[model samples]
Target: MKKIYLLFISCLAAFILNLILMNSAADMPVFFTSYLNDLLCMPIVLSICLFLIKSFSRKKSIRISLFSAFSLAALYSVYFEIYLPKVNTRYTADFTDVLLYFSGSLIFWLTHKFDSPKNIQKTT
Candidate 1:
């Protein structure tokens, strides 16, 4: 729970910074302007989703499976990078974004930890 909160807050901070950079006129590196958001997308989104799931399920020991995380990254890549680019002028296809999405998932997977049953304390 602490780890998830930290991950969520850190990613949220990065996202806010990125949003500021996006809206500001200050010249920034391409990474900050473009790829940073892509790199952050999954962790931020997944953290929120996981938080909601945990809240509703009333479970403190739940964590996302690696396969589920990977599948979501793949789905986002296909939809945003492949499909959206073809249909929307605002979107552009970039294979690097696909890699970044998976990278973000991996980051989320590594950082999103919860106590196991053995470690959880039972209240009397």
Candidate 2:
């Protein structure tokens, strides 16, 4: 659980760095400026969601936590990839972004499950 909190903090730092690289005028590769931030979207949101779940819930449940992570990812994907483009001139829908969100959510879910002590059964 403490490690999960650390992971969330690290993800937050990466997200902030992505924001900086996306907005900075400094000369850099397009990958850093455009795709990097998009790639980080899922992990950022998923981590925050998972962190909140662990923080507030007295009895932590993996199923519930994973559900919340993916649900938030889905909502974010829809809002950013579908709704935002229609409402804002600056935002445009990209399928890659949607894929990234799903991919990130899946990765987070798998890693969390594997790393959790509760998931490991002792062979007596």
Candidate 3:
């Protein structure tokens, strides 16, 4: 739980920094301005979602499965990259963004953990 909270806060802070950099006039690398947000998106969103689910279900052991992470990545890719681009001129499809989304999902899957009692053992 502490790890998840820390991960979420760190990711959120990165997001805020990215937003500030996006608006700043100082020259920045393409990765910072363009791809950092995409890379951070899923971990932040999924962490929040997981927090809500845990709160409502009151299950400390619950975690997001890999399949669910992949499904979410696919859904986000379809909507943000494929569908939105077709409908809105402001949005353009980027395959790299899709990949970054999946990468973020993987990060969430790997880092989101709950320190449940079941995970601990009595030692002599």
Please report the TM-score between candidate 1 and the true structure.
Answer: 0.87
lDDT of each: 0.82, 0.68, 0.82
Q: In model 3, what is the error at residue 20, expressed in angstroms?
A: 0.8
Error of 1 at 107 (Å): 0.5
Per-residue lDDT over 16-122 for candidate 3, one digit per residue giving the tens place of the 0 to 100 score? 98898779857888999889999999999888888787688755567787788778899999999999999999999999999999999988877753334354321
* Candidate whose lDDT is highest: 3
Q: How accurate locally is residue 115 in candidate 3, as Cα lDDT from 0 to 100?
A: 36
lDDT string, candidate 2, 1-124, tens digits: 5555565567678879877766786787877776666666666666665557658867555333566667777898899989999999899898877777777777666656666666542210
Q: How many Å off is the CA of 6 in candidate 3?
A: 1.1
67 Cα displacement, candidate 2 (Å): 4.6
Location of the lowest summed lDDT over 10 successive residues in candidate 1: 115-124
Highest TM-score, which number?
3
